[model samples]
Target: MLDEIVASRDAAGAALTAEVDAVIEAANAMSDRFRAGGRLLAFGRGEAAADAAHVAVEFTHPVIVGKRALPALCLGGEPALLGMWGRPQDIAVGICPATGDLAAARSLGLLTVALTANEEFPEADHVLCARSADPLVAREIHITVYHLLWELVHVFQEAE
Candidate 1:
């Protein structure tokens, strides 16, 4: 089982590397949107939501020595709001409404970035698109995505 897990990880890593250019490009686009006075919003369910929140906090408060604060928000942070929304999918849409919501309207200038393990959600301007092979693999991909996002944000910030 351990060997199989290691082999799976190795395969995932190889596949991920093959798609690095596309990932970097997507990250760059996201960074551009964010630099233009747009907020990077992350949303997911359960553990994925926790991962989203973790990434959001990292951007809001960079641990890196010289990195500056970048605007990032997680839609699942408020338990009351989540409870009202009922599901992660609903919250994703609610947070970045197509129209109607005053807060969403106010945040129109901000770029809405969505991170989800669920590919069904249509609100995501940029989707991380997690591989559904194994739980551990999914987690690792999320971590990679966050790290890439951070690097991209820094690049965008520096170019300003």
Candidate 2:
């Protein structure tokens, strides 16, 4: 069990390393949007929904000192109404897998993102693939990814 856990961590590190630069770029873009008064809208299904809420909370109230509290909302249901509240400058992060809202986000001119294990996810301005089929491993990787996002976006915000 210990060896399996170690191997899973290794796999997550390798996958995330390949995507780090893109992740940082996306974070910068998100920071830019936030600076322009754009909020973040995240959503997912079942387990991912919890992460969506978590992401929103993290951005809205960062633990990191001096990190601004960016506006964020997690849509749990009734995705059809997203456009009503969503704005062109907002950012949307679709967690775990696509629930069919990325397209709507794009149509609304919002920045779009998809975080999933599949190579084919909702088309988005950014796609951060967790690259793990195992749920436990994916969760671990996701925690790291979002933590980095929260921290790094602060860096970009400070730079701006």
Candidate 3:
């Protein structure tokens, strides 16, 4: 059982590794958006909604001292709320989004990012897929990816 778990994670990690360049590129774009006064608005349904809240807190209240507390909000999977608050410079991150949310965000000119496994969100400007079939494994990979994004965004911001 443990071996299966380890192998699954290894495979997922390898898949993400192959996309490291894309991740870095996305992070750089995120940094640029932040520099332009953009905020991150994350939304998801059910369990993913909790993850979205965590993502918001991570950005708005960093665990590391001296890390910039960027503006981030959890939309509780409410695309209507996004319509109310989204701006052209804002970022819309959909963690396993329902149909049309990412589309709506893109229609409003927000940079769309999708964190998902298996499900395809074509509207997202950046799609960070977990490469795992298991829901738990996918969730773990999403957490790692978001953390990397948070760290890399700061790295790029500081470089400026």
Candidate 4:
């Protein structure tokens, strides 16, 4: 099982390298939006939701001990919000509802970045499409995508 995981990871890395430019472009776009006083919002379902939460926490609290804060949000933060508000077909609506407890957060201005294996949210400012070949592979790709996005945000913030 371990060997299979390693092999899959290796294959994912290779495939990701081939699409490096697209990844970079997506990251840069997201970074730009984030740097513009726009909070980064991420959401997914099940394990994907867990991944989104992990990505959000990484930005909110850097693991590097001492680092500047980066503004980010996980849509699943409030269970009530998730339950009461119907999921939006588009990410913009999901993250920027006019009413509800999240209205205050949305008023602050946020850019929604949806990470999904499905192409459901077309209106998302930035969508990191998870590779659906394998669950492990998708997780690996999502992690890489998150890191690239964080790096891009760092650079963009530094430049400002």
TM-score against truth, every candidate: 0.70, 0.91, 0.95, 0.65
Once fitted onto the true fold, the runs of candidate 4 whose alpha carbons sit more than 4 angstroms away are: 1-7, 77-112, 118-121
The prediction achieving the highest lDDT against the true structure is: 3
Which one wins by TM-score: 3 or 4? 3
Worst lDDT run of 10 residues, candidate 2, spans 76-85
Q: How badly does each model clash, as a count of residue pairs?
A: 0, 0, 0, 0
**Which pairs of residues collide in candidate 3?**
none
User: Which sections of candidate 2 miss by over 4 Å?
Assistant: none
lDDT, model 3: 0.88
- Candidate 3, after superposition: displacement of residue 134 in Å? 0.2
How well is each residue in 1-160 modelled by candidate 3, as lDDT tens digits?
9999999999999999998887888888888889999999999877999989998999999999889999999998686688889999999988877767788779989988888885466788998999899889899988988999999999998899
lDDT of 1 by residue, 1-160 (tens): 9999888878767766775765676667666655555555555555666776776788889888899887766776443343333322221212212222223422333333443344444434444545446776867876776787678768766887
TM-score of 4: 0.65
Instruction: Give the Å shift of residue 77 in candidate 1.
Output: 7.3
Question: lDDT tens digits, residues 35-73, model 4?
Answer: 555455555455566766777787888776546677666
